[model samples]
Structures are given as structure tokens and as C-alpha cells.
Target: MTEPRTETVTLNGRPFFLRHWGNERLPKLLLLHGFPEFGGAWADLAPLLAHRFHCIAPDQRGYGQSWAPEAVSDYATPKLVSDMAALIGDAPFAVLGHDWGAAVAYGLAISRPDLVSRLIIMNGVHPVPFQRALAAGGAQAEASQYIHYLRAEGSEQKLARDGFAKLLAMFSANMDTGWLSGATRDAYVAAWSGPGRLRGMVNWYRASPLVVPKAGGSIKMPDLPLEKLQVRCPHLLIWGADDRALLPEATAGLEEFAADLTRVEIPGTDHWLHHQKPQEVARAILDWFPDR
Candidate 1:
């Protein structure tokens, strides 16, 4: 694989950091990183896919070197989805997302399917099922309790202090993080330390309206038509079965939103499945979408 070029693009006058690999002439492949992660999280997967497509991963909204506005409104779903739409442009590109990035991808696919050629989700939930899981309180609500903490005032300082101790603790709480070396730790520390970056990232939680019910509490879903939110495109969901944060249950009833939904469950991994099994993850993607 060729060495990736680091570049920046202006979206709605806000600058976004990007890492590009492969030939730009090839069909585009856009990758989005999840919470507590930056575009560089695709370091391993991008290179593998670059040979087949022009792979570019952007530091979305409030992460890494992207524009990190302090207002919660800036991180709202519409704004976040627009950021992706701007990056995708007029051409249809395959979009891959994980965690919070997945939420953004789902929004884009549902609201503006023209920009998305296909959708690949890894441990990311669709709105209806995810909101259902959050409202139907149980394991998912218990797992997502941290969302409340992130929404709390002053949570930014707690996560940033001691070199992002609390943020790193969140990663450790769920899955195996034995792969994080001193150097990797240093890079994450740098990304999280960006000016107003921590506050901007946390605002994603603050701006979201999805309510996670408390223990023994049951919540209700909105009375909207599934077709309104259904992903009207080829969709592939690659799940990390052992994910403690976004449990597998969130995927229940997902077929109702994706008519052509395809699922591949890779056992024994958690939320950070790409880092743990990049090759297998890439292979799953290749099997589903092929080289196009």
C-alpha cells in the first residue's frame, strides 16, 4: 500500500482533517471513525482497501484535527450528517462507520440516500432499533449509562484531565485493549488534547435526544413510518458479538429498516473489533461489497 497523504477539506467553511490512500481515480470509499477515535483509527483497514478503492477517512466534526466547535447545536444530527454529505459530494461513495460515526452514517443513508452507494456498519446501531433498545431498558441501558456521564456538565474536564484517564478507562471497561501501546496511547492523548476538542466531542451526547431509560423503565418509539427512516440502499452490518458498549440486542428488528440487510457476526470481539481484527473485518467487507 502507498503511504497515505494527509489533507484538509472545508465543509460549510469548517475545516476537516482527512487521511487519503490509494489512487484518487478509483471509486471512492469514505470511512468514519467512532467516539474516542479519530480518522487514523482506519490506519490498518484503509491500506488494505486502498488497492481496490480510493480510501479516505475524515476526522469527523469534533475529533482529531477537524473543526471542534464548542456549541452542542453544532454537533446536532443535521449538522453532523451535512459534514458527511459535504465530504461525499455528488458522487456515490460506500460509507463505513462505527460507534457514533455509525449514527452519522445511518442519518445520511436515511435522509439522503443519493450520496450513499452502500452502507457498511460495524457494531453501529440504526435509529429505530437503537432507540428501541435504549427505551426498552435492560442490558443496553445499563451498558449505555456512560452516555449520561458524557452529557453531564464538566465531563470534558474529567475526561481530559490526567491525560484522558477517564476516556481511556471507558475503553478498558468494555473490551480487551491490550493492543494499545505507549505510542498509540500518546497519539490518542494528542488527538483528545486538541483545543475545545474534548468539549466538542462530548457535545454529541448533549445534542442527541435519544433517551436511555433507567433500570426497569420502559420507553416508547416514535410513530413514524419505517420507510421514512429505512436505508434505501444495500446495507451490510458487521457485528462484534462481544461488544459490551453497544450490545448485539440493539440490532433487533433492524431488517424492518433495511430491506436488503446482510449481517455477519464475528464472534469474540468487542466494540473495538476493527483494531482487534482488521484483516477479518476487511475480508467481511470485501465479501459483502466486493471491489465494485
Candidate 2:
């Protein structure tokens, strides 16, 4: 496989790192990664799509070599979405996001519809439905208990201790980690080892407005304006059915918000499906936008 070209672009007055695959002349595809991972998270999937699209993966605000702000408010969803907006400028492009990256993708699509031609989410959820599930204190809330843990003060230090054993455990819990060994594992460790990176990454949880209630407990749902949360572009959701962290409930009612939504389930995989089954994930993405 060919290596991705690395570059830096200033966004929000801070230098942000990016990894590019394929030529810039092709249709642009922005790939957003999730927690405990950076733009390099697309290493397995972007190359497969490079044949037809210029895949650009950013390390996001707090991951990899990108700007890592110390304030928790800096990781807010709107701020995160704006960073991507700055990167893309005036042209609209296709966007794909996994895990926490999906939150920014959804925000971009909703807040700046003209910036996203198409939206793709892998093992991620829309905020409205996800927040509902989380507030209900059901399966999804139980699964998302880690969010609170991550938001706790000094939690990043704890996760980084003992060679990141706690972080690794949290990442691999009830998921397939066979793909996370050798060099891949070392790379993740290195990213986490960056000064203040872990705190910056966890701040995303602290800054989130979603409320995750305790199991068997329910909280009043926030009044989310549906009009402001609509995904106007074509949307594709590729789910890893076996994911334990994000239950199906998290994605329920997604169609109500997405104008044109298509869902495809890839069984026998979990949260790391992109890593464990990149070909299938790529195929689903390519198939969704055949005419592009």
C-alpha cells in the first residue's frame, strides 16, 4: 500500500496536521477519526478509496500532531466542526467519520449543509437519537458510562498510567483488538504519549452536552430543535452489529433527522470494524455513492 502524504494547515489560528492519499484533483473525501486515535486511524480504509477520491484525514483538534488546547471548552462540538469547515474552505465534499468523529461530521452536515455533499458514519450515532438513548438510561446509557469516567478530572493521567494499560483495556473491552497489535499498537501508544494529547482528547467528553444517565435512571430530555439538526444531504450509516459500546438504540430514529438515509450492517464486527474489516467498510462507502 502507498503511504499517505503528510502536511499541516492552519485552522482556527492553530496548526492542524493532515494525511492525504490519492490526487487532489479527484473528488474530495474527508475522513474524521475518533478517540484514542488520530487521522492515521484511516490507514486501513483510505487507501482503498484513494482509487476514486482524494482521501484527506485530519488528526482533528486534539489528536496526533494537531493543536492540543488545554481548555475543555476548546473541544466543543461546534468548535470541532468549524475546524473542518476551515480546512475545506468554500468547496463542499463528502465526509466520513467514526466514533467521536461522527459527532463532528453530523454537526458539519447539520450546521453547514453546503459544506457536506454527502455524509457517512461508521459505528457512530446522530446526536438527537443518541442523546435520547443515553438519557433514557437504557442499554446505550449503560454502554456509554465510560463517557463520565473520561470527563472526570485527572482521568487522562489515570488512563496514561502503567503504559496505558487502563486506556488499552477501555479501548479493547468487549471488542475485537486483534488488529491492534505490533506496529499499530506502538503507533497508538506514541500518539497518546504526546504531551497534553490525552487530556485534549478526553476533554471532548467533558464538553459534550449529551447527558448519560445511570442505568435504570432517566433524565429529562433536552429540547433539541429538529429543524437545526437535520442532515440535508444524502447520508449512509455503516454499522458494525456487534459493537458493545454503542448499542442499536443509539441509532434508532436516525431517519427522522436525515433526509435521505441508508443503513448497512456488517455483522461479526465491533467498534473497530474499519480496522478489522476495512474492505467491507470501503465497499459500503463506494457502493453508497456509485455515481460520484
Candidate 3:
């Protein structure tokens, strides 16, 4: 098994920490992690794919040792996408993202199609369909209600109280978390314990423009320009069928945006499917791009 090599690279005058697996000479694959988790979140999956590609996982803006700005506006989609664009320089690479990281990955693919050769999303949603699902006040909206709580004032304190009991509960809610124990659990806690890291992580929810309506109460859907949001690259979506937070509705009509989209659902797994079944996820990815 290949261990990750850690380093810091400056993007837009800000330090973004990165973890590298496999040889630098290999084909590049950028890995983006979601909220409350750092680049290390890819530890299990990256090594498996490292033999074929150079796996690069970044802490992103608001997590781990990356440059986490204080303002909510700093975490906006454009900035997040720009951070990634800067990191990759001029090379076109494969991009894989999970959860909030998927949002950034989609943004990158949409905004800079030339830079992304392939796109992969693990249990994540695109903004247009996700927003529609959120506004419909259905299962997805109800499941996403936690977004409001995380966006609320002093949410960081609430999540941090009692040694992050609330945060841990939220992470393990309706999902198998047997993998998140001992040293793995300690690593996550230590990352969250970083100064302003909790607030930074929560700020992703606060900064997002997607609106989640109350259950059984519908809201007007915002205008999303489909032409502008289309993903031109070959896209693959790996779903954990049991994900409660992001229901099937969240990914509805995703094919309209991704001209070439492939979806594979791994059974008996939930939102943290990557953590729970890295081998299966890696196999799915490897099978999808056998020539890579």
C-alpha cells in the first residue's frame, strides 16, 4: 500500500495543503473532499488507484491546513473552483469529488471544461437538480434541513460542544460508522479541533446559495442556466443507495446536464460509502475507465 506524501502549495496567494499518492509521472487525478473532512479523507481510496494515476487530494479552502478565510463569501463556488484551477495549472486531469467536494468538482467541470478530462462524483449532487429537489419540499428537502442548522449563527460552538457529540452523531446518522473509530476518529477530531476549522467547515453550508424549504412547504425554484451548467466531460456518478441525506431525487435529471453520464450504485452503503467501501468504490472507478 502506498502512503501519501504531504505538502503545501500556494493557490491565489493562499496555502492549500495537499496529499500525493503514486508517482508524479503518472496520469493526474485530483481528489476533492467534502465538509468536515480534510484531504486525508481520501486516504483509503487513493492508494488503491495510485498505481494507475497520480492521486492528489487537497484539504480544500476551509478544512485541514488549507487557507481558510473568515468570511462566508470566501467560500463561494467560483473561489473554490478557482483554487482548484490554480492547483492543477495547465494540465487536464481526472477529477473526483464527494459531498461538498462534488459541488466544486461540478463547478470546475462546468467552468473549465478544458482542464477536466473526466469527472466522478460519489454520493453528491449537481446544483440545478439539487436546488430543485431542495425547493420541492420533499424527501431531499427534509433530509437537507440540517443545512439550516449548520448555517445558523454559532453553529460551530453547538457542533463542538460535548467533544463534538452532535457533529459525530450527525456524521453517523443512519449510516454505518464502524470504520470511524480509534485513530481514524481521533484524526478527524484533531482536524476539527484546529483553530477556526469547525467554523470554516460549517461556513460551506452558510455560503451555499441552495435553499432548502421546510417539509411539505414548497418554495419557488431559482433560475439556473442549463447552458452554463452543462458538464462536457465524461462523467461518472457512484451512489451509495442507502444515503439518507441525499435521496434519489437530488440526482434526478442529472443526465440533462452531463451529456455522457454513467451511474453505478453500490448496495448496503450510505453517504459515507467511500469510507465504508473504498475497494468497491475504487473498483467501480477503475472499471469505468479501464484504459486510464
Best candidate, lDDT: 2
Off by over 4 Å in 1: 290-292
List candidate 3 segments past 4 Å from native. Answer: 290-292
What does the lDDT read for residue 237 in candidate 1? 97
Each candidate structure's TM-score, on Cα atoms with residue i matched to residue i, is: 0.96, 0.98, 0.98
lDDT (Cα atoms) of all candidates against the true structure:
0.87, 0.92, 0.91
What value of lDDT does candidate 3 attain over all alpha carbons?
0.91
- Where does candidate 1 clash, by residue pair? none
**lDDT of prediction 1:** 0.87
What stretches of model 2 exceed 4 Å from their correct place?
A: none
Ranking by TM-score: 2, 3, 1
The RMSD (Cα, Å) of candidate 1 is 1.4
- In model 3, the Cα lDDT at residue 264 comes to 98
lDDT for each residue of candidate 2 in 156-254, tens digit (9 for 90 to 100): 999999999999999999999999999989999999999889999999999998888876788999898987899999999999999999999999999
